[model samples]
Target chain A: MNNVLVFPMIVPILAAMLLLFFRSNTAVQRWGSVGAMTVVFGTSVWILQQVMLHGILRLDFGEWLPPFGITFVADSFAMLLVTVSSLVTVLCLVYAAFAKDEKRESFFMYPFALLLAAGVNGSFLTGDLFNLFVCFEVMLLASYVLMTLGGEKKQLTEGIKYILINILSSWLFLLGIAYLYGTLGTLNMAHLSVRIAEAGQPPLLTTISMLFLVVFSLKAGLVLYFWLPGSYSTLPAAISALFAALLTKVGVYALFRTFTLLFYHEPSLTHKVIGYMAAATMIGGSIGALAHRDVRKIASYNVVIAIGFILVGLASFNIEAIQGSIYYLIHDILIKGLLFLLVGTIIHLTGKTRFDQESGLIANYPLFGWLFFIMILSLGGIPPFSGFAGKLFIGEGAIGAGHYGLTAIAFLSSLFVLYSLLRVFLIMFWGESSILSKNQIPLSKGMLAPLVALGIITTGLGLGMDYLSPYVSEAAHVLMNPDVYIEGALHNE
Target chain B: METIIILLVGVLVSTATYLLLSKNLIRVVLGTAILSHAIHLLLMTMGGLKMGSVPILGDQVDTYTDALPQALILTAIVISFAVTAFFLVLVYRTYQSTGSDNLYELKGPQDE
Candidate 1:
């Protein structure tokens, strides 16, 4: 359990150092990135096993006692996120190896990629607020580099905006941490939870909670997500895909962590606020998606829409709602990753991103087209795909929680998402074949292989939900019953 | 002394917010820099300011300043510095490419 808990953090840092020595060799850097992600993937599997056998694995760094040192807690929830992130990253690296232009290797893309993996894993596993903030910075730094990897005019302009917004958010996050630490006097999340409970919902606590909410909302791309379409749309397809896949989920994870662990008492206010924001984010993002003609913009807006649903799940604040939220998070990460990868492949094949510029992609490239169609359908929350199952759980949870209006909103927004995706798929794949030239759609085995694998896994997720439900339920239980987290952190202190 | 520091932080925050609202990219960068510094001071102040007493434990002074917030602020200061440097570089690159420093002119595809 110790080894499994440590693997995600150790492998990436070690691989990053090795890559620094072999920086001159592009091939080594590429293979090194793949090998590192593979190890992370393997370790995630082992950690999942340990999590299944034992309830949770808590590793205190430097063997320092709780409330003083950093701790990594791996429960079913954390392990699930780590596994999904590892799978997406591994596939993205494989796809990038082929889909990327020749300039990818020269840009230190491999090292930054590993840093991103480390950041995601760190965020998922850490049991401290400040440590989570550090992880956010680590991930944001890597993302800034990745956004500007190409160094083109568009990339630089958009990348600056992205970095600026995220930097400000980090500062706000720091301020929130200071408030939390000053008021609570402990950085350990579990211990802080008990402190907050003991402190009995002071005004200052509510203010700090609101600050944390805003900071994470910016990262999660809720209503303040205007930066996303600009920044993510400007990046190369694969990088955009990866960012679209996992970055916002990290923010959602933070939202879950804070609300569940620290701010659970004020459900009427916190959950209501999140619910309202979720509805607004959904409508705005759907409209944005409908308005965009570019593939990347459409996908990016869809990410915002997905965040809305997750927020709704959180807002419900019941056992089923929390479980649904976790389940939806897992589903969204995989399906969104697949959608981005597929769109990247489409761009790679056609050299065009707008629907107006390209036509009949399906006829030109049948394999890529069909895979993209399946991913698009799944993304639209069609049946028998991962998206449908997630939406169903959240919808049911909302209904069960007696939020009938929100349930209706969720259903309507899901349709809007379906409409937007179907519009794009139809335009790109099923339209006239006359517009496309005989370019032969250069499909690389490396890129196509990962897309296919991800597509299959996303499909399998829908079918295997029965097996996955127990884990999601357990995660929800852990989050709902904060005593376990409190005990785990304060144990032997 | 703590009151003065709090007043100074308020001034810095207001000034930075004004700059952030401006149209110039350089002003926005400066605003972020100033705002982060203000936040660091605010964090330090939250730990309760003590005059002439270092946060580190020593032989003479019985009451050491609270060290936790100092450590946190120090880490934050370094992180803010790195982020500021990165933002500066990004602004420079954006200026080089777009040939202008006005953020209003750098509208994205949606603007088109």
Candidate 2:
């Protein structure tokens, strides 16, 4: 019955409505969106504090009891993501303001972005399965608009593929929910957990879980990631970064929630399948990243690789592994956002998309070069960076769980990340300048501010682990032990 | 009655699959539309067929048909409707700009 859980989802809707009135004024649109996101960020942090102090919080609509009415539960895991996503969205909005697309600005971009945020927040906080489906649609619908906002030919083609694939996956989602409801006769996640445990996860239940796996895997870009690179590479830098940072993550979050809470009885069947998919995703994404010469393609493939790495922890299914998954999830969101912003800025400056066509960016933008190098190191899991801690914990957990092959493949993929990104660095930064000064777009402070902010934040996340770990461990504790969540959600009366 | 509905759903699904595999964009869009309708029917049938009286409760009623699936299908129908509308608009715009409705022409760089 706590009230604050609604703020993260509701505030964004209110802000979107506020932004709609000022559509013609780009200044209001830009700052208003940023201001709204900042508010969400603050609200999420406060919610995190509340969860830490009071334990899990659930908001039942209209005071109806759980297992009957809709619910939004704020546990430590969801609030952590909600907070980080809101912060990253703020930075993305700051970057979008500098994008001089008049039509994009006036065409409800701010409102749609806010709606997307609202949907994402709702997905995180939702306590029921059907509510989660609705949240996914809210996010996907906004994303379709964002993807095709400009109506360019390339965007149109890729947008069609993206929308179609998502629609199909969403259909599958509905089918899964319908079957589950037919069997359990309840959509509340907590009640479903109880029922599945009582039913002992029969063969039929496991099959249904597989359907959910495929649905979420497509959304998360795990193995069914075919639509990602092309669709993502076509959008403007800011929107693309937002999609890269936030969209797949919600899918991953759903995977974490369902597998940990609803379908834990048969790890041999379900988690084993996830392990194979994670391995394949790693190998495939690495191959794609190494194969591409276009900077956007390279960056997009890097996103796939990160998705694989995070899920390896999930496949392992140990406490340390879950904690590592959480840690790595946060790191990936921040670093990927930073990585895309850097790649986009580079493409913007050189007016070229491929690495072969541009060189010696360091000679012109030393700060940008160094920041990119930091991003590379952070991404590759070097010591004293955000990526390192998560990889360490996940590796340790995988080894503890005796998943030797998965551990080896996971670490090797880090090498792939290092090699692919370093190749981009050595070639793109070290050579003689290709574009003349007269032709190059000046690197603006407005663009660089967001990157610099993300750079420091990722570093801070690494060094400030002593503070963040308590929350991460708390999240992992609830994830590892679903009883805590179930008790809180179902016994609130 | 339930078996008949399920058979109808299968027929619709086969039709959708055929249309989806075509290279024309309009057929693909229509395939998705029909596919959604098929799913909506399946969802409704999953909740039992008419078990008893109206869902509205009364002292006289001994049993009532499950109404949750009806609510779910209603929501699903509206959503699929909105998405189909948007997808149709996108296909039209793609045709207007590219001068072709063939998925072969819409293939991206990797496909080539």
On residues A1-493, what C-alpha lDDT tens digit does candidate 1 reach at each position? 4646878877897898789887678878878898899989998988887777777778888988677878888877888999989889888888788765668677688888899889989999998998898888888888888988878888888887788889889888988987777687788898899889998878889889999999999999977898988787777766777798889999999999999999988888888889989989998998998898888888888899999988889988888888878878988888888888777777766778886776777887788888888887787777787877678778888988788888887778888888887887788788787444554656778888988998898788877778888888888988899887676556733
Model 2 stretches astray by more than 4 angstroms: A436-440, B110-112
Alpha carbon deviation, residue B110, candidate 2 (Å): 7.8
The chain B TM-scores of all candidates, as shown, are: 0.88, 0.95
DockQ of each: 0.69, 0.75
Per-residue alpha-carbon lDDT of candidate 2 for residues A1-493, written as tens digits (9 for 90 to 100):
3888899889889999999999788999999999999999998998899899999999999988898889999999999999999999999999989766688988999899999999999999999999999899989999999999989999999999999999989989998998899888999999999999999999999999999999999999999999999999998889989999999999999999999999999999899899999999999999999999888898999899889889989999999999999999999989999999898888888778888776788988899999999999999999788998999999999998889999999999999999998999998898998767677678888989999999999999999988999999999999999899999888954
Q: Which 10-residue window of candidate 1 chain B scores lowest in summed lDDT? A: B103-112
lDDT of 1 at A279: 89
Query: Candidate 1: which stretches are off by over 4 Å?
Result: A1-4, A435-438, B51-62, B109-111
lDDT for position A147 in model 1: 87
All models, RMSD in angstroms: 1.9, 1.3
Query: What is the overall TM-score of model 2 with all chains considered together?
Result: 0.98
Question: In model 1, what is the error at residue A348, expressed in angstroms?
Answer: 1.7
DockQ of 1: 0.69
Model 2 chain A weakest lDDT span, ten residues long: A433-442
Lowest lDDT sum, 10 consecutive residues, model 1 chain A, at A433-442
